[model samples]
Target: MKTPYRLILLCFVIFLTLEGSTPVPTEKTSFQWKWKENQVLELNEYHNVFFRVGAKTVEREDKNRVVMKPKKCTPDSCLVNSWFDTYIRYGKTSGPFWKDKEFTSDFTLFRNGRYEVPNEFTMPNLRSFPSFPETPVSVSDVWKLPAEESFDFNSERIRVKVIPEYTFQGIFPWSEGNYKGNCEKITYTYPIFYSKPDGEKMVPNVPYKIFGFASGTVFFNATRGVPEFKEVKLSYTFIYPNGTVQEANFHIKGIYFLRNQINTKDKESIREDILGDLIVGYTGDPNGSKLGDRIKDHNNDKEPNGKNLGRITDTGEIPRPEKDSSLEKLPVSVRTSEDGIVFSLDSILFDFNDSKLKPDAETAVAKIAEILKKYPDREIRVSGHTDNIGKKEYNRKLSEDRAKSVLHSLVDNHKMDEKHISFKGYADDLPIAPNDSEENRHKNRRVEITLVLD
Candidate 1:
């Protein structure tokens, strides 16, 4: 339909206006980490500990909660105190329960992109994402992260102070509509840079350098002050002066969020979400079976060479040793021995390198005393043994002191007659296990309680 030129031109203008009214997505985006004081950030960290023996992997899961609280804040910087609240192992062969062990530290972070750590405390694989730029950034923008940081390696065998360099590898939207919501993927890489150990216990003029490499992805949420997701894989190589190379690889993954203290109406939804988290905790590593099977196959392949790389069971169903019924009857059982009816207390009864009995020791001693009261005329003997780690004389005295400590605990705390009880120490001369490995050495440290019928 041929219309007037003026009318046609008006129609074209209207079309253009309508097209322009719709918002067009921009390629550049900006984010800021303006954390406020008293803000508490809670994170669930899933750590995979793998001891790489040749090609076989002995893997286990170490899970914990990392809590961060801002202590003080300024216009451009803030001091954050972070601590591990609880540690839980997924498998049966779990390491020590670190619930009572407090590993807390603080660091200063700046708005202008400066991350500083204390000289004394260094937590490996614990770091925040690189700071965002003051201006908007596009894809393929490369930048440098904060430096002058330190990390511990091999339980303080060596320390490395490093300045990290990073390149911004573009950002993308992560998890559109889940609990994590929309997040920004901040990708970066840091090379292996080595430095001398700057620890307090580091000897002067030591001829060795600690080297390491770390690479990771950090996901940041626009509304939250902390990263919603972070995964970092760290590899460390310790070079000794005597030309020994010890390597360690660790993988750390974190899912973090802040509590919605203001949301009262969403209480039901929050409860459901928390129940879901609890289910995940019970499940342990979701992929533990598949990964454990792969490791087991690899270890089995190496068994032809008489190599026992040990079992890498599923963290979900790691096998634990069967309970011994004899040990269960320890408190009441009185076994016949050359001296008399004897009962034994292993190193587990006491703290390491201390004569003081543990809290549970009192209950055990009470049980033993109850049994001994039935045989009032029998004389009791408490003997202590030690592993061969110290001087002969010192070990002998330590054993004697430990035996006397137990004897005194029975007499003073349990009101047992001192006249019918005696104590002795056999330091390192007798051992239940070989003193080669730590487990054997621990087994060698024991105390026996013998009751004489005379």
Candidate 2:
């Protein structure tokens, strides 16, 4: 026998509870599909290299920019032209890998939660945001995408199929203002299925089957008709024909904006950072604001007292070369070992397929002569290497000739003691880099000068 007021309160409480448990429909009016013309997006990526070679760490960083030039736009479909620039930097060295490559893409922003990626632009695979549902998808929603288009690989046509799944993770906060949005967490567990032409034999000890997967979270900024940000983790596994396995992992992050905002301070900061890091970016001193002038100043800066650089120990350990002084000032790298110091000059000591010393080579040899004059008792060893492009015998001959040329230059031009110096040639055997690409092949051809503490 409840009272009338008590009965009314109970009903009201029940109504509120039901409403709280129910799902809220996505607002269709807020969605905008693509960015406007002249809008630009700047992105920075810091890669922590966990992969180790013996005991060395190879850390890297990359910077990229994308500028939009909309050719056509509509609620159902949009076509946008873009310019992309990517620069990669490694300890003390950096350069442009994609140096302002341009491309065009067509997109369809559907009412249902779906995204379509550009067919070309395979280097990045999914360059920009893929499709997302127009309506908010819940954790219960099972997302799927159309199979990716086929492509040619290694003179054979290859096919790839993709299976995508999505889940609503939570809300993502915007950086510009107090705007909070939905976050969709996705995992492509069986992301790609690769298939090659029939009758293709798998090489033993080489990978035959390769699989890829990706997991990431995308922040839905529906009002802008694009995602605010996306962070993805990608991985690939290679199964060799001999049952061995290898894997690689990559992290990709992206952020987008609807309008162009000019910030001079940020621009200046980026400029200064790039200027300081170009080559020897980690150690380059900022002489002035102007990059060219600063470079000139750095080049002019010379080492003091070059003769008092390195010393020999009674325990027979070779001493470290003085930095920014004698050999380090040249384009060559000086490395110390237990018995001696090795000056490694790859392609810098000689021209392609020719061992004849260039003007710069003469200067570098003169510097070495000065160092040798300081240590008359130390013996020298010169070794040369060539890539495996030509016949093995021919390569051996070339390498030997190159080593002799360097030795002669030291003995004749610089008057280094011929008796104290010895030379050897290792043709296409001991390679510093894989001869798979032109860049790496170029690196394989090198000359080394070692000063042994005898």
* Per-model lDDT: 0.53, 0.48
- Candidate 2's TM-score reads 0.41
RMSD each, Å: 24.8, 20.0
For model 1, residues 1-454, the per-residue Cα lDDT tens digits are 1100000000000000123443434776555564545345656555666554345445555555555666666655667676653333334434322221335667776664454657654532334345566565666666675443244334343333444554444545554123354566766666565655466354332325656677777676544444667777877665555554556566776666554222333333332232222121123234454333433543556323212222112232323332321122232223455334566666666787888877766666665666667655444777789999999998888887788787888888887765446666789998867999998897678777776431
Q: In candidate 1, which residue pairs get closer than 3 Å at backbone N, Cα or C atoms, i.e. clash? A: none
lDDT of 1 at 356: 82
- Screening candidate 2 with a backbone cut-off below 3 angstroms (N, C-alpha, C), the clashing residue pairs are 32-225, 92-280, 113-133, 113-134, 114-131, 114-132, 114-133, 115-131, 277-281
* TM-scores for candidates 1 onward, in order: 0.45, 0.41
Go through the candidates in order and give the clash count of each.
0, 9
How far residue 278's Cα lies from its native spot in candidate 2, in Å, is: 23
User: What ranges in model 1 sit over 4 Å off?
Assistant: 1-27, 53-58, 86-100, 123-129, 153-180, 195-207, 223-225, 260-454
lDDT of 2 at 191: 72
**Residue-wise C-alpha lDDT for candidate 2, range 1-454, written one tens digit per residue:** 1000000000000000123444546632222243443453323232222222235434444334444444454444444444444434454323212111223334432333233445453322342234344445555455554434233234333345665555554444534222244543433333754643479887554445657776766665444544566556656555655665555455555554444533444444433443233122133333434544444444566423332233222222334544453323335556554335666665756667787767556655665666666656444667778988999988887887787777788888888765446666789998978999998987788777776431
